[model samples]
Target chain A: MSHDHDHDNELDPFAARVRALETILTQKGLIDPAAIDVIVDTYETKIGPRNGAKVVAKAWVDPDFATWLKRDATAAIGSLGYTGRQGEHMQAVFNAADTHNLVVCTLCSCYPWSVLGLPPVWYKAPPYRSRAVIDPRGVLEEFGLTLPATTKIRVWDSTAELRYLVVPMRPKGTEDWSEERLADLVTRDAMIGTGLARVPA
Target chain B: MNRREANSHAAMLPAGVDAPVFAEPWQATAFAMTVALHDKGLFSWSEWADALSAEVKRPGAASDGHDYYEHWLAALEKLLSAKGVAGKGDVDALAAAWERAAHATPHGKPVLLQNDPSPTEGRGGRIG
Candidate 1:
């Protein structure tokens, strides 16, 4: 005898609830489901860490933009057109020889979504949230990132009021590299401070 | 999950990859709905944040973060009700309707609101 579970009989409460909510909203003409699809597609394809990468690469090559980013990250990042919810206020923390920056939201997952698209599952996980602050170096080590022993680790706790973007140090041997080339080296993990920018081989 | 299922799951993930961005599709839809509602000017980002933060910080919330999007959906529901959009009772009722609709829906067919066996009064008028 074969034991096959009936999928229809075992409807997930959460999925049902979500579908019900969508249906209700649609019936009320509050939201077009197509619009939701477009937003999802935009985040999946267009708006993401690549936008942050552009900002990082620009900062890498342009000293003035770097200064501007440090002074007013909101305007600096907005000037590049990566502005939206969860990113109303921005601060660019530059990772340097003496200091490394890591971002976490202990209160909640207050990620810079406009620049970073969506926060990774681990970013919102309790272990990373509670441990990133208490053991920043240890968390980095788990991600296979090891900073120099002398480098100080600074953890930024994101809140509803402000979000942080880490400006990782530009890897060596890219002196004459274009901003586009530099952007390619900026990974999502690097912007979030879990890992460093890739060093072109 | 059982050991065999866990191994299959691990096999699916590439090296160094932790987990999928969303464990399920509803999570993505819930996320998109929140953004779409905000785009419709239903609430400010700060207001949305306050609702979500409240849900996330609620006592005894899931520690593994697997239920993070559940909180997210709850926040959206709370915000919608607070804005006088859809009340809690309405959402619960509709969810029950969808549950019926899913069971009523024939296999291999889309589960639509119209498929609800006992479609509640005044809820039948929907756009597509």
Candidate 2:
């Protein structure tokens, strides 16, 4: 005789509830399910982290844009067509020789979705959310990104509707590099202040 | 939450605000369901307030965002089921079907529910 446990009975209750909700909504003709998928795909791929990278690259090469970004990030980011919903209010924090910037939403997971798209899991997880504020230097170290002891770390807690985008310091020897080339060095973590921008090799 | 607080929760938003940030497709599906239900006037704010609060208390844990949304979905379902918008039994059954669909489908592909409920029967089924 063989006894077996069926996995179908083990669907995570959370997922099950979501699926059930979807079924009920469709049956009531509340929405077209197919359309939601298309929208999800669009945000995940077409309008994602690349938008932030472009902004970072532009700031690295254009001194005027950097000044504009510092003065009025909302308009500067909007001028680039990256303004919407979660990113209606934008603040650009520049990393300097003496300071580094980090962002977190202590209340809820508020991010600049229009520019960075969906946040990575770690960003919303409890450990990163709490530790990023209490012990940012330690959290950065865990990500293998240790900053100099003298560099003051500024943690920005995104609340209500305000969101921030980090402008990483430009790597050395890239004075003549194009904005497009400079953009390649900026990573999501770098913008989030967990890691540093890559140096051109 | 009171009337004012209930209205402010992100889950109660009409629809289409931020980029779709789903830990999984089901999460997106959940959000769409709530938005759709709101558009249809299926439930009331007081009902939403009670259900959501019951499912998720507060943001005690920092990493509880995903779980918080999951509870939000659960609250939505509870409200719909209680209001006879849908039957609880049928919902459970469909959820089970999705689980079977997931088991039958290969990794990296979408797990679509099959007309045949027991799609995982026989043919190795990855049995131990």
Candidate 3:
């Protein structure tokens, strides 16, 4: 007999069952709807990606600070007073002109929300997740990032306790740029090591 | 209790062991926020997604709302920590404050539920 699993990409039976259970809890009023709202809003708004931008900007302007960031990301970040829940221990890597870096939580989704915000659905997709660690260069290529054969590719897998971020090299011709302007060029992917910050004309 | 009664009672409890209408939707919100930040040049979309996807694919991952938020929060923390922008303590303190505020006004007005786009709406072109 053909089982329900034969269906393509549909919600699994277990998932449907869980959805049904959640519906009942919502109707029963055991959990407060407002509380849930608070949780969601807090991450979406009050917390922002500026913190991460600041880090990237600083690294670009100050080489010493960039070295400090890569060496002890947690303590250096703590100095900025941006610590908490999943960000207790952090590490930063620098992707230079000759090297490309990417981060993945192969085991789980560990990210830096205090600075970068929430994750996108594609990040949770299976194709990117499975191929990221196995062939970092291939995944980068799909994203239109081609690293030279000489460029070292480093991939960091996130754990429940430790999280990682990539600090892409500052683009050339930004020597006289202000911190804010430099920050404008720092993208979330640049920090995550998947891509580089684009330069403006 | 009879099997039918047990089944009915099971239905009485919330699905996924978390608030359904409120919780399940946050994942998309989190996804959008991250996407918006990336689009605004705060970070790259690929790296952000890679970090979070790893968490969702973890073994024994909780199929409930709590697991979702916990992982999302963890992802945010990891990203911030990696950039040397924030520390774990900062997040914990904020979470503690949130808990206190939540308890103080159990019946207070809803927050975080406003201005969310519909599921069908485009997520700022980050995801295909």
TM-score of each: 0.86, 0.68, 0.56
Clashing pairs in 1: none
- Model 1 chain A poorest 10 in a row by lDDT: A1-10
Off by over 4 Å in 3: A1-35, B1-128
Ranking by lDDT: 1, 2, 3
lDDT of 1 at B80: 91
Model 1, residue A127: C-alpha shift (Å): 1.0
Scored by lDDT, the top model is 1
Cα-based lDDT at residue A125, candidate 2: 57
* Top candidate (TM-score): 1
Q: What are the lDDT figures for the candidates, one per model?
A: 0.81, 0.68, 0.56
- Native contact recovery (fnat) for each candidate is 0.44, 0.29, 0.03
Q: Give me the runs in candidate 1 sitting further than 4 Å from their true place.
A: A1-11, B1-18, B120-128
DockQ of all predictions against the true structure, Cα-based? 0.34, 0.16, 0.04
Q: State the fraction of real interface contacts model 2 keeps.
A: 0.29
Interface RMSD of 3: 17.5
- Candidate 1 per-residue lDDT, tens place, A132-155, comes to 898888778777677889999999
